[model samples]
Target: MSKSITITNEDILQEIKLSCKTPEIVEQIVSRKVIISAAKEAGIEVETEELQKAADLFRLINKLTSAEETWAWLEKHSLSLDDFEAIVYSSVIFGKLSQHLFTDKIEPYFFENQLDYAGVVMYEVVLNDEDLAIELFYAVKEGEMSFSDVAHKYIQDTELRRKGGYLGIVRRQDLKPEISAAVFAVTPPQLLKPIVTSKGLHLIFVEEIIQPELDNKLRNQILTNLFDEWIKQQIQPVEFVKLFELGS
Candidate 1:
């Protein structure tokens, strides 16, 4: 005879409310629980060192230095250590689940789309004067000076100029449409001609472009995103009783 695990629907609902702040958010949260449970059932466990590593990562990501400080930061956002642990555990489970499912299947897809994953490194010269911009553009094109040198000598944007006008690895999608079009059109180690946009007259240089790879790290990230979407879809049909309505 097999023993039955007896978790009531109400118990599950209350757990969801406490973890997610709303019963309507249950399915996504519960799906993480499902992953966690699956991991445990498979005799998988997150070691203390692993949890500490995750905590360290969490702290660094939020610019904190210690677990206590991380917990304090979470409290400021109305979250608790238990909540943080659950999220970390869910992340571990999700990674394990991805390794089990799509790590092999998606590697080829990742390699095929690798070019789309390139990141840009750029230098920019921003100027308010259109005529000055045109003159500077000519100077740059004629090799009178490098973009960084000109930016340092004459660009008005102090922050960018200080870094020799470096606007570091920005995704094409994140840039303004005209700017993106201009930048992507140029191959790396090449200077783009001056572009006029709403901001100002700009000259850009492509410092480098990093091609993508089909690696374990990227595969895990893709699977995590996919699972999150899947969980959201599963939860969409669920209806819930609000706390205020329950009180009423």
Candidate 2:
């Protein structure tokens, strides 16, 4: 004999909150539904062969060598054959639709935001104490101590301290607005004074700036970002309803 338990919608919401994934899971479900709808509207087609190829790739990734192994994999994931096929078909359609819609927009978007996309190499020291941050900045500026040595000595994070506070190649938009403005304003080998932010004070040392080029890698990245932005905008007006509501 076995006993079954009934869970309400509120129970599900509580579990999601405890897992710290409430809003993210909701957004993901909405995004998937919206993307699938967009794919259908765009008349994107996924043939039997394409779906089979996707299934083959999935099987290969999972090391499912035979039909029985694949079936076992599906069972493990609690998916029927039809369910797995539908999932693969939608994924293929989504990929095709994304490429179809955003492939042409990559170049212009890249050119328009070239400076923001350009990579900057910098060193940073962040301190919670403003006075200590200012003191360290002046110490480095007056040549009383080497910046690298000072950063290694004072940076709180173990990984960053070991790296001597070096923040490798990054885009302008990757940094906070205040830090970005101050750092980009100074030339290479120049250190910006302590900047106050909610996090604390920051000392910036700009090393070099790498200009953005429309290479194959960057073009692909820009296209993906544009597609994601377009998808978000498309889904913004979509209304999602709870399938199961508590009794009134």
Positional deviation of 27 in candidate 2, in angstroms?
4.6
Which one wins on TM-score? 2
lDDT of 2 by residue, 8-40 (tens): 867767777788885678788888888888788
Every model's TM-score: 0.59, 0.79
Error of 1 at 228 (Å): 4.1
Clashes of each: 0, 0
TM-score (C-alpha) between model 1 and the true structure: 0.59
| Number of residue pairs clashing in candidate 2, backbone atoms closer than 3 angstroms, sequence gap of 3 or more or interchain | 0
The C-alpha lDDT values of all candidates are: 0.71, 0.83
Give candidate 2 misplaced runs (Cα > 4 Å): 1-30, 56-73, 241-243, 246-248
lDDT of 1 at 137: 80
